[model samples]
Target: MKKIGIYLSFAALLLTVGCSDWTQMEPVDQQPVRPSEQNPELWAQYTAALRAYKAGSHTLVVASFENGSTNPRVRRTACAAFPTRWTPYR
Candidate 1:
């Protein structure tokens, strides 16, 4: 009975280790998504903000998002997130 149990365990381990081909498996072919694809207006806002941010005026960048946004959270978030895109922290 002990020998039978050991053999069954070894067989199970072998079956698990040999279950899949390491090289022949296909890679996932998922395409990257851009904000422009889902919401062009939001993309435009982000790009405009990014351009403004690159030019060094942050106040106008945050204020540009004043009232046109339907979601207040995105407005507040964009205010916080844009400036941190470049950092030296030194």
Candidate 2:
């Protein structure tokens, strides 16, 4: 009885702990924009910035992140630190 009680408790704990609520965004008709094709001006600026970074003119860190994860402060700081890559970063 004690072993059965322990097993039942463990199963209940596992079931509850494993449950999670999922959120779904409203559906969109259009496909998502590709990074390179998003903006011509920003693409040009990013390329120029990449070249400069390669030439040792300045350090550059290219980060691929989701829109939901974008932070306002990080965007502002990245733009302020390196103007050329600003548009692409956003």
Candidate 3:
């Protein structure tokens, strides 16, 4: 029948459109490495802050370090150690 032929053609067209080649997805830049990654002291400071937060010592956790350290590297290291989150002392 002509209706059956038309239905098959429409189904073929739908299948052709649905079976697209989706292999080339855009690459995502996941979790970029920071310059501080190479610096051991900076990493230590960051880890210490994280540990303090985990240990629930909110007061001891430094939000920001004094910027006036004689060594610029020390100041930078301390700055990186700043806590990412602050919880009020209960």
The model with the greatest TM-score is 1
Model 1: per-residue lDDT, tens digit, 16-69? 788757647688999998879989999999999989888995544334545455
lDDT of each: 0.76, 0.72, 0.76
TM-score of 2: 0.29
C-alpha root-mean-square deviation, candidate 3: 19.5
Deviation in angstroms for 24 in model 2? Answer: 13
Over 4 Å off in model 1, which ranges? 1-9, 16-18, 21-24, 57-90
**Runs with alpha carbons beyond 4 Å of true place in candidate 2:** 1-30, 57-90
How far off is model 2, as Cα RMSD?
16.1
**Model 3: lDDT to the true structure:** 0.76
lDDT of 3 by residue, 1-90 (tens): 999999999999988888676655878989877757788798889989989888884555456445766566653466666668996768
Q: Candidate 1: deviation at residue 75, Å?
A: 45
In order of appearance, the predictions have TM-scores of: 0.39, 0.29, 0.25
Over 1-90, each residue of candidate 2 has an lDDT whose tens digit, in order, gives 999999999999988777643344667799889778889889999999889878886656799634444455566445345555437634
